[model samples]
Target chain A: MKIPTLHIPDGFISAPVSLLFLVISGFFVFLALRGAKKQLDEKVAPLAGLAAVFIFAMQMINFPVAAGTSGHLIGGALAAILIGPWAGVLAVTVVLIVQALVFADGGLTAIGLNVFIMSVLATLGAWYLFRFFQKIFPKNRIGFLTATAIASYLSVPISALGFTFQFALGGTAAITLDKVLIAMVGVHSVIGIGEAIITVLTISAVLSVRKDLVFGASKLKVSLVR
Target chain B: MSTKRIVQIGLVLSLFVAAFVSFYASANPDGLEFVAEQVGFLDTAKDSATGSSPLADYGLTGFEDERLSVGIAGIIGVLLTAVISFGLFTLIKKR
Candidate 1:
């Protein structure tokens, strides 16, 4: 089998839709930069760099999820939980840009589409979901991993939905919408499990040694009565 | 652990994964590409503009050994990602 191009390539979506997403993605990157400025102080800066490198490295490994299908960590959820949503977006954006420009893993024209889904949609969505779950779970290691697993799992399907939405708007092919939805969501659901496992494992690893580095863990409030 | 230690460990782990462990990754089409194929839209996919890059598809062009090609490319990607992201975060920290 040929080495899989891990991201959306050109011609999957129409030119107009791609350009539209370019503008949208660009705007989000700008917002991320502004927001990241507040969180990316001197101490957190190197951690952010390590997080991006780890993400890029992990994306290289595609584990087989099912027959004829493989999956890799998106790492958006992992980054968001490790750092924060804003900086997470920038990290993933950097990965996407590098992959596109250097490795050609993603298409040039489709860079915006990839960024919107992986960087904006997955990172922010996972962060918010994690925050919600954090309220329900205990403020401990198990609780943190549970929340990370749940949020990261859902984040993958959410990203799949992003692609489905774009394809519906401007797919170059004439595939049926329902089929596209079913196949995309079905495969991604399995892929999401891989994402969840990796995210949880990585989070737990860091939490074991340096829990202070995890942005999500830092937000956990300890009860005075407990 | 000190911040420097954490970065050091993380870097080592990342390099190991990208350079060695990644060589064993599954070669099957990923979820997105699988969906496109099963849904009859795979043909709509076109070559990326950088399809001919030396590092396109995560393998070094002109290298006969697939393992070495991919391994080297993975290392390059990790380093590039580290530099760009670190520079970006430093700039953000300053601003």
Candidate 2:
């Protein structure tokens, strides 16, 4: 059981496919900047930087699960909860760029798609879902954690679906959409549980520290929300 | 300490460590590579020949301990990423 790794290698995708991702990523960065601009007050800048760094650090500690399978923090939701989603998207995109260009973990050509699926899709998708879930849940710790869990889990494969579509359309390989979708969604769902747990625990930790910082923890402010 | 300051310091340190340990990563193929192999496109994966740098493919002249070499490569990656990211952010944003 392998996790849906965000790092797509080169030659696996065509130039046009990679270029499309590149353009999408650049556009998203612009959108992220605009979204972040609203809250980029002098005070928020430092916090934003801290959030970016936190994401970077957390991505490093990937946990092993079920033999060879392992999963790492894709903190898009956590970031969106604290900073706004646009800025959170930017933070994750920046991390991806650094990973590709400087770290060489991800391919340079695929940066756009990586940012699109992993950062933009993950962060924004998770934020919106969390917002929706927060409404129906019990509005307590259980509520917050459960919403966190569901949002994080679903957002992952949704992003993977986006990737599956992209790869099926523009992939260099001769694979079918059905298989790609099946394999991607299946593995990522398991990985999503890990993501959900990390998201819950990390959000809980931050909520305890500076309850003000955890964006999704808003309802928890009621002194003892479940 | 302020969450801001604590986060900044912690980020810098962690990035440093990630970069260093990246140099010694296990040679085992990552999730993507493993899947590519199983799915039948691993061979099609191309390298762009972007640089003349040593240690391409996480190997320094095709060393035997490819995994250790790759881990070390990962560590270096994080360091370079942190430096470049920190520098770019500092230079462009003027924060």
Candidate 3:
């Protein structure tokens, strides 16, 4: 059986749209570098690398989420919570690049699209949502993990909407935009559950032994329930 | 645990997952692919330009064993990701 992945292949989107995203993605990458410089200290730098490695590894395991549909970790929220938003973007971007160039999982020309949706939008968007949720939650370990899970869950469908928007703009196929939106969002909502489970579990595991390493933990002033 | 120890252990777990556990991943289409197929635009997708690369599709070239093929590809992917990301982060970290 031919295994299907979420990495967008070529020909589905127009060249102009693809190039547009490429430039957009490049700009975000540049900003990430600048932001990472300030955010990544000596300790966080290695964790950033491990974040990329872990994301790459987890992406390979596509658990069955729905009938005939499997989903793997996007790791955007996990990255942002563990590392900072900027490094999180870079981590996921590096994984997408490797998957495209080496594994040929995604289209070469569509790197920008993939990066924009998964790397930029997912990571940055999740970071903000995480901060917001962390404030409103109980401010304990459970609240932290709960915030992570919610943000991570929403990130999947949010990124899926990003794809839909791009498809509306430059999709080559003669399909209705509404159909794409509903289907993309529907399946992704289910997949988002899987994303939430993996992300919360990973973050919880890290928090267990090394809460200090978690970037998001810095804001939660409450004592951890060790 | 120290940050170095955490990172070291994380890397080992990553390697283990990619190289061994990945072999058992479900073969069904992912959410996006399934949605695309269901929405009727899946036919518009084109093959990747680097489809002929030795490690294309996460399988090693000239390797027939399914387990070893994906496992080796996964290992290579993990290492490559580690090198590139680690180096990049090291360079960009605050001075």
Candidate 4:
């Protein structure tokens, strides 16, 4: 069960609503670039590129979460795990923009909202929660997996609320906010399992290969941050 | 990682993706489709207004060879995504 994309139905978004979200997402991308520049060491750059390409490749192969539901990698946690939060948001936003413009997988007008909810909100929110969980769990694979799992689960409906509020604010559908929220959150809870497993396994594998590369993976040398 | 290592990783990952998509994807309706059906607006999802596109519905276009048509579409999608992603990254990195 793929965490359903916050793809607003066509005709459901007005020009101004769409424009506002586009601007918000654009501003965040700018912020992320600035953040990356501050955080960038020579090593993080190439790894981020490798990581982005990896995320792009993996997204094409969604796994079945249930009988009819298939879930794909949002890769937000993985992104945050490797890069810092702001950089992670930017990475996912870039992917979404490419998907919108070239693939037509998600709509153009709805693109802004999609990126905002799916990329910015999910990645940043997941990053914060991941850190919180990391503090409590054991400082090893279990810590990483537990944090990734909870963060992945929380992110879906946090992004879901982002979508719901948008719909409540600008929806064309006669559907109520309660109905929308319930449906979005409920379905996403199921989809989140696939995301959690993927995030955990990916983080575990990468950390084993190069713990130096995973920014969110707990404990490393003092001089590495620069 | 070495350049050769990076190439190897990319190749293996892409192959894994191709295999998975061609086989493991769920045949049933997704959440959106389910919601639409439940809400009785499923009919609204007919052809797009800009309906002249060559590839739609992931190319299950009533072709005689179901597997070939779908497999082709899936492969095309992966190629398009990779090319677009690589191009976007290259341009952004240049700046």
Candidate lDDT scores, in order, read: 0.90, 0.64, 0.91, 0.63
Specify the highest-TM-score model's number.
Answer: 3
- Tens-digit lDDT track of model 1 for A119-146: 9999999999999998898866677678
Q: Which parts of model 2 have CA positions greater than 4 angstroms off?
A: A1-6, A65-67, A218-226, B12-30, B48-95
Where's the lowest-lDDT run of ten residues in candidate 3 chain A? A1-10
Evaluate model 3: give its lDDT: 0.91
Query: Interface root-mean-square deviation for each candidate?
Result: 1.3, 5.0, 1.1, 4.7
lDDT of 3 by residue, B1-95 (tens): 98999999999999999899999998999988888888889898888999998999888898888899999998999999999999999989887
Residue A179 lDDT in candidate 3: 97
Candidate 4 lDDT: 0.63
Q: Which ten residues in a row have the lowest lDDT in candidate 3 chain B?
A: B31-40
The sequence of per-residue lDDT tens digits that candidate 4 reaches over residues A123-151 is 88899998888877776666667887899
Ranking by DockQ: 3, 1, 4, 2
Candidate 3 at A215: error in angstroms?
A: 0.6
Native contact share for candidate 4: 0.13
Alpha carbon lDDT of residue A94, candidate 3? 97
Task: Give the chain B TM-score for each candidate.
Answer: 0.96, 0.53, 0.97, 0.68
lDDT string for model 2 (A74-126, tens) is 77877786666876787787777665654444677877878888888889999
For candidate 4, what is the TM-score?
0.81
* lDDT for predicted candidate 2 compared with the true structure: 0.64
Candidate number with the higher TM-score (1 or 2): 1
